[model samples]
Target: MKLFDFNKYFPDEKACRKAFKEMRDREGVVCQHCGSHDVVWLESKQQYQCKHCRHRTTLRSGTVMHGSKLPFMYWFIAMHLLTATKKSISAAELQRQLGHKRYQRLVTKQEHP
Candidate 1:
């Protein structure tokens, strides 16, 4: 898809988050603490509560975005660019495209976790 279409599909942070949650739901969420698959989404808290253990897990807990402070849109955009592009794009180029002020933060977020 084109950049315009990508932007239209993910117009805001909420849209991106909702999309992520839908994908996660399809794959199913397993409780990290109790090792159970009985999890339900808590819309008010934006987390999953394990029915068996009562443990709360954030949407990003086991995903690529885990422990990262960047917005969901950033991850979506980065994924789109990385997969859609014919040529390999550098991290610096991605940072510039995202209009992020610091490259170190992006590198740290991508590399550390």
Candidate 2:
């Protein structure tokens, strides 16, 4: 089961942003137009606007749940618990934790990458 404590997953925005940044930086973002790694972060917008192409890319772009219904915090909690537990949690477990019956249907009905 998720058994996630939201406070544990997203205790603060800074922590969440730091974790997200680390993951995002693991494979540094490259400009789609020029293949340049140089970029700048816009705090107000929370997106990276490539210094090369000036393209605006969202932190959530191209992620596994790009268009999924799962909240970012929930996803983060799920991932953390799954990794920490080192055991696969079933949909029913996640469904219970999420408190959304529709999630079970979505998890079952949709395909995951």
Candidate 3:
């Protein structure tokens, strides 16, 4: 078995989209509203819909990226960096590396004030 690399391959929306589509298809997408396989793509927003209940869900919905303003590549890079290190990197370090001020503030508020 070969380990998949995100930085070496998926570094953009197109790659992420292709991988997500394949994975979603393989695992099958369940409607967030009705838990049905009958779904449609919303296109402009990169979301899926439940034909039975008309519920729309995003690619990042229920995912780690849910409610994030960061780009898809940011998550990929962060994961790759985290796995490459041994001693464990702090959120401050990760935030500085990724240059995400939002997360920086988020972690800061969570830890201190």
> What TM-scores do the predictions have?
0.90, 0.70, 0.67
lDDT of each: 0.89, 0.66, 0.69
The TM-score ranking, best first, is 1, 2, 3
lDDT of 3 by residue, 18-64 (tens): 67666676777788677898988877878888998989887766666
lDDT of 1 by residue, 52-92 (tens): 98999999888888878889989999889998899999988
Worst 10 residues of 2 by lDDT: 104-113
Best by lDDT: 1
Between prediction 1 and prediction 3, the one with superior lDDT is 1
Ranking of predictions according to lDDT: 1, 3, 2
- Candidate 2 residue lDDT tens string, 18-58: 67767887878766567778988788998888887899777
Q: Which has the better lDDT: candidate 2, or candidate 3?
A: 3
- Residue 104 alpha-carbon offset, candidate 2, angstroms: 6.1
Give me the displacement of residue 24 in model 2, in angstroms.
0.6
